[model samples]
Target: MTVTLKNGVLDPQGKAIEGALGSLGFSGVGHVRQGKVFDLELEGSDKVKTEADLKAMCEKLLANTVIENYTIALD
Candidate 1:
């Protein structure tokens, strides 16, 4: 799963990264947004139920829904 701040939210870390990249001679870099990635291994094989569980996890704890968005990808 990937978690990221929603648009229009303040991203101080990302801004810092952008400035660092500029100082490192990396040009044309802007609007860098930082995020998180999570990898979980579950015992279920049900796609529907697993997806539901993942979404629930995100809604309940994995992400701050008011300021961030989470995406789940199963493979």
Candidate 2:
């Protein structure tokens, strides 16, 4: 039950920032992709609750709801 940045999504912000940095005389920088990861240590939490909590977190805080995306892993 993880969500991550989908392939083919244009990362304009990342590209712009990379471009700016390169223009500042810092070359050899390219291929910028922005994404997020969430690490959770559940204290033996139930599966349903964990999923609900994760979903809520993504909907509320983890994700941008506009541009940025996120992914969660149960490790």
Highest lDDT, which number? 1
Tell me model 2's lDDT, rounded to 2 decimals: 0.70
TM-score for all predictions?
Answer: 0.90, 0.52
Off by over 4 Å in 2: 1-9, 13-32
Compared with the true structure, what per-residue lDDT tens digits does model 2 show for residues 1-57? Answer: 344455567877768878988889998997767565556777766877887788789
C-alpha lDDT score of every prediction, in listed order: 0.96, 0.70
Alpha carbon lDDT at 67, candidate 1: 97
Residue 44: error of model 2 in Å? 2.7
Consecutive 10-residue window with the lowest summed lDDT within model 1: 24-33
What tens-digit string does per-residue lDDT give for candidate 1 at 1-75? 999999899999999999999999999997998999999999979999999999999999999999999999999
- Backbone clash tally for model 1? 0
TM-score of 1: 0.90
